[model samples]
Target: MSYMEENLEKYADPEMYDHLHEGYEVDLKTILKWAKQDGPIVELACGTGRLTIPMAQKGFRMIKMDIK
Candidate 1:
């Protein structure tokens, strides 16, 4: 089986993942601080776009990717 097939259970519930990750902003400040505002940022394994959406709102061009 492929990687995604094997990991189906892990990525099955997006809502659960979001709930678990909600209010977790430990990395946001650092990421914004280091990342250039005028940017085309590529975020691999960007599950549920938690960071991608915020960055895009801040005017960053986001290329988000995930298997599911």
Candidate 2:
């Protein structure tokens, strides 16, 4: 199978993906620190909005996109 197909099969279940990636906050701090606070931010491959939600709560207008 192609790499894309393999990846899709591997991450088909959102719940399982989330569970597997839980407690993954290594990039949160860096993103928050560098991201502009005044307005919109676009996050590519934003899986289930894990980081997007928190940034939104912090008053950022988040634009999220994911392949799922």
Candidate 3:
């Protein structure tokens, strides 16, 4: 397995991983605006649902998946 796959759980747990991002915010708005589509969205590496959760709350259909 790849190093990331081996350590996937460490990154997958929100409680364990969320603290790693403490204050960082991903700018999904610009990406959304640029895409010009509300989705059905396909999100890769959707760690802790950071962007995915909000977009889903906004009513976009999200397919969230991650290898880690």
Candidate 4:
């Protein structure tokens, strides 16, 4: 398998992955501060967007890009 696919397969259990990664989620308050700004936010190699989605939820304009 490709490297990315291999790693994804390792984390196939969503509940386990979510539980492990959830702590890395972006703090809503921090995101809100950046969202208050007018500049666009870009997360290169954004993984699974654990941070990106939350920032987006707070009305932040975030562009998430990941490459395998």
Candidate 5:
């Protein structure tokens, strides 16, 4: 497995994972926004950076990471 994949193999806790994803403010509009721009951002243990993604969509660079 990739180093990234290996590291991320741990955030797989169903209960916590579900709750985290449930907390993000995500939408198609936001994704579209990010698709049009570029900058630097990192969603460490990202679990869905509801805000991070939208911001990234709005033309910022970003990297996504998760802890296993």
Candidate 6:
């Protein structure tokens, strides 16, 4: 496997990744605004649904994908 594939589990740990990215999701309003204007969104490496959930909650259609 590639190095990134081997390390996929680490990135897939929702709790661990969320904790590590504690204040990293600062684009809530920005994403919401854009999604409101634009159409659906596709988020790559959407770890833990951190921003995805909120965006969906705000009525945006999002497709979240990840290595896991």
* Model 1 lDDT per residue over 1-68, tens place: 89868877766799998998898877877899999867599999899998999889988999999886
> Which candidate gets the maximum TM-score versus the true structure?
2
Over 4 Å off, model 5: 1-39
Model 6 CA deviation exceeding 4 Å by range:
1-12
Q: What is the lDDT of residue 56 in candidate 5?
A: 66
Q: What tens-digit string does per-residue lDDT give for candidate 2 at 1-68?
A: 99878968856888898899898888998999899977789999887888999889989999999875
lDDT of 6 by residue, 22-64 (tens): 8776687676655662677899878779998878887778999
Estimate, for each residue in 1-68, the C-alpha lDDT of model 4 and write its tens digit.
89978976845665676678777645655656645548778888566677778788767788898664
Q: Candidate 2 — which residues are off by over 4 angstroms? A: none
Model 2 scores worst on lDDT over the 10 consecutive residues at 4-13
TM, every model: 0.81, 0.85, 0.62, 0.55, 0.39, 0.66
Clashing residue pairs for model 2: none
How do the candidates rank by TM-score, highest first? Answer: 2, 1, 6, 3, 4, 5
The alpha-carbon lDDT assigned to residue 15 of candidate 1 equals 93
67 Cα displacement, candidate 1 (Å): 0.7
Clashing pairs in 6: none
Greater TM-score among 1 and 3 belongs to 1
Candidate 3 per-residue lDDT over residues 1-68, each given as its tens digit: 89867877566567868788765655786756654354488889887788888777877888899765
Provide the global lDDT of candidate 5 against the true structure. 0.62
Computed on alpha carbons, the lDDT of every model, listed in order, comes to: 0.87, 0.87, 0.74, 0.71, 0.62, 0.77
